[model samples]
Target chain A: MKLGVSLYSFAGDLQTGALTVDDALRYCAALGCEGVELIGEQHIPNWPNTKISDLDHINDLCKELGLEIFCFSYYMNALSHYDRRATMEEHLEMVRLGAATASYLGTRIMRPAFYGVPVENMIEMIKAGLPIAEKYEIIWGVELHAPFPPVYYIDALEKINSPWFRLIPDFSCWQTAGAAGHFQANDVETLRPLLKWTVHCHGKGHVFDEHGEEPNTPYKDLMNILKEYGYEGAVVAESEGWITNYKPTLDVVKTHFKLLEKYGR
Target chain B: MSVELRIPTGGSYALTEQFRELGERVAFPDLNLHKVEMDGMKGYEFKLRNPWYTEFPVSCAEDMEVGINGYAVQKGKIFFVIRDQAVPFKYAKNLYELQWGLGEVAQVRMLDGQLQAVVKEANDVEIKFLLRTAFEGYHLPNNRIEYEFKRNMGVI
Candidate 1:
């Protein structure tokens, strides 16, 4: 399992122009991250407006840093009621555009959220997007948010009807929901079976208690599950704030990396 | 356009049912709820607050756009509580295909159809309520909300 960070954690820096995409990648490289999850809006300037050639420049930079591109994160709510087809078209085009860009970046996974409408509409919307995903030979990895029912996640994936399309499970959300006894995130044993289908993962980090270390991810247990199943996707640190105190977060991830390295088959 | 409101938990079936009711109330001839079963449910247990407070559109933009000039087409608004679940992307796909963007300006309006210019606090309230509700509904402990949206009610 390769480790990485989503650019979202650096959103404040991006807006302030304090960090460039290059700078972010450099930081990741410095952290010994094997990859970086590129949130287009954060790392790619002129984003939806960015040209294909511009992205190639980024791909080249990643190669130079020895950093693999994990996925292009585009967390959007597709269900806001809009007045014009032009705007809706623009949003769809953005995804289609990202698909092309992801292809160029040597990864075909487009990470998105299933938000806004109810689950049925979410499924319909996802189904409608198949053409775009298929057109670009890209997989649609819906990041599972906590309020969304697990049934909806499964339903939508099955409906999308593509091996390329799957769920990018946010273990935190799962844990949160299960903490209430509403669902269960602890069943890593069950998830282990579906390892082959997992394109990537969002290793969201958080503090369970004040004294607990940053990114108190149940890493060892998760890694054990992945190891048992021979799952080989990047367990990207798709989180925020864990690295604000860069050293500690880096230590946490690096330690996890070592653990994965030790157990990784 | 006409609008009707209902309250249901945050899931697809509830929203589709509400939409169907709204479409029927407005006399739309054809409306379809695409069917599919999604796996790896993540946030199913999050409780909904006042789940009865769902809205259905009463008008179509095609009609309003012709008469209103900046006067822009009034994309109908629906107000509901959303917990800090995964960001919903499928909603956009459905709306795009169905031809509705989150209004023109992404403004936040109240349940009574009044725009709340200073919606940042109110937006946070929605999120908090949803999270609390989800926790109670699911019986989960220690899932604090980490992010939220307070931007315009319109879509970008």
Candidate 2:
């Protein structure tokens, strides 16, 4: 199980310049993250206001630190009634540009979502988005985010229907303001069948402590599943730092690293 | 300590008025829903649902940047159908009402929308009313709104 982190957890500060790319890389390296997921919006340019040159320094900095980008996060709802067809086309093109940048930076995954479509339309959207994915040789994965419905792993894979299309499993995405029952009742075992399609993992952990510093992820269970299936890909910890703070979330990743090292097969 | 409003999109002006009335009835008189005019994209209409609800829409714009506490309502000003159900599941009466209790559950599009969530538990009416009052009194900036109406209420 490879480890990584979605820089989104720190995006607010990063956007304000309080957290630099160096700060994030050091944090990831310190936490033992093998890679980092770049939030394309915070760093990408030209959807009208992109400062393309701003990321030049960032790309150079990543090379110096030996850090790798696991995925280019492009989480958008392509299926909205709000925009005209041109809007959708524009959104997809922006993702293509993002994929090209990710490729240049050495990552192969870019996540996009067709927001607002009926569950039945998931397959069509995934299939429709394929050419764009192929255009960049980027594996476009749809995330099982909290706001979206509880999409089953198998059904999700079936709907996506392509090697170019896949799942970016956020282990903790199932956790919400709702109780642990929602997570406990999930069919994690069923995911074994879809492991091959999982390109990236949102390695988010949530502890039940009121202080918000506890590590409550079922790492052993997750690792056991991954190991049993021999899954090898970037499992980037999407930080709960927004819910907790930076240090605590970083500490949890460190703790997770220790756990993965100890119990990993 | 940041607060936001989520509205559903694609509904008619009647539904939009109802949503606004609901907010004003609970006293967010200053609440205004604006149309987002971004470059190279279609414009969508949306309105404010509830500002007190913690979960707002995450807007991934054409620029590939996604921001929380914001949403892009796809069709019209109203996109979701609003209903009040007698929740069978337990929840807090207000944001302050339940210090540790899980709130009530309202049966939703059992199988509809982006989140396959059967039910999105928001604060109970009492809590929502109270929170709306408290925040309105505190003078908060209306951060974001989601489109809640998707079609003509009479049709759905």
Candidate 3:
């Protein structure tokens, strides 16, 4: 499987001006990532209103940096807006925009989430996006989180089961041993069956000790599961520990890289 | 900073009369509002801080202060609660982070071609914090408040 980091791991740092995109790329390469994921909202200047040239510039930069831009994270939710139909229309346009960006970024996979909407509704929304996705050769994948169960999308996947639809399994769904019941981060056993539909992964990392100890998340176990499934895709080091503490956030992110080195195939 | 409380015209969340009846004065505090501005949804990433609140957009550029505490939901009713120091606002960052992005807490949905915000706070304080600066730093007020083109009371 290809290994990488989502620049979002540096969100706090990016917000604080501690990390620059250029340095982040070098940092990812230093950590031995085979590819990388991009968060458009944080990275793009004009963002949703970005010009095509800007997309081309980023794509060219990634090529020169030798970083494979595996996926562009585009989020769409049919339920957030007041008008579901208006929201649907808005997302249909967003799909076209995302596909255009993905085409320029040199990646064929775009990760769009189903936020606060039912599985059927989310699928219906995704169907609206498929025509554009096919046009750009970008595959639309849903990240499996506590809120988004993989099974929920199964019926829809079967109905329009094109190679364009896929899943981005976030390891946070695999809770740490004895973390908290409230987190709703799933266990490996529950997620094992969902692997068949997974195409990419977000190695959501958190809390690492100085002794190279295992953090709350079960990275090793998750890596093994991915291996068992013969999965080959980008594993983005997506961490969130930076929010609370200014210190040790990078340490925790580093731990993810270490764990990946040890267990990731 | 004071926020203009717009009354619900007509819905299950009609909160105009309720907010006008609020006998308590709402206080304000430093808050990080979560607001999600729809720009075709530029991107998605799970922030470890608070996933539930993540969808809501909060701006460092915007001041975290408010004149009123915010809105609350009790037994299926929405109320404007004052942010009193004695009764602090409940920062459910942890709960919001854990409860699957807390989709049930303060949501936006469709009703008769209109977009309405639906919020279900666990407690009065949490709802206040939510409304004042919870997600977008605003709440449901049941008072008839409007500014005319001349910036005055009811006029033609």
Candidate DockQ values, in order, are 0.03, 0.03, 0.03
| Residue A236 CA displacement from its true place in model 2, Å | 1.1
Structural similarity of chain A in candidate 1, as TM-score: 0.77
| lDDT tens digits, residue span B59-100, model 3 | 111111121123322221211111111111122222211111
Best of the candidates, TM-score: 3
The model with the greatest lDDT is 3
How close is every model to the real structure, measured as TM-score?
0.55, 0.56, 0.62
- Which candidate model has the greater TM-score, 1 or 2? 2
User: Which stretches in model 3 have alpha-carbon errors above 4 Å?
Assistant: A77-85, A147-150, A177-182, B1-156
| Candidate 2 chain A worst ten-residue window by lDDT | A77-86
Candidate 1 vs 3: which has more TM-score:
3
TM-score of chain B of each: 0.17, 0.17, 0.16
Candidate 2 lDDT, A63-88, residue by residue in tens: 77667888876535232221222254
After TM-score superposition, the amount by which residue A122's alpha carbon in candidate 1 deviates from its true location, in angstroms, is 2.8
Give me candidate 2's TM-score against the actual structure.
0.56
Model 1 CA lDDT for position B138: 21
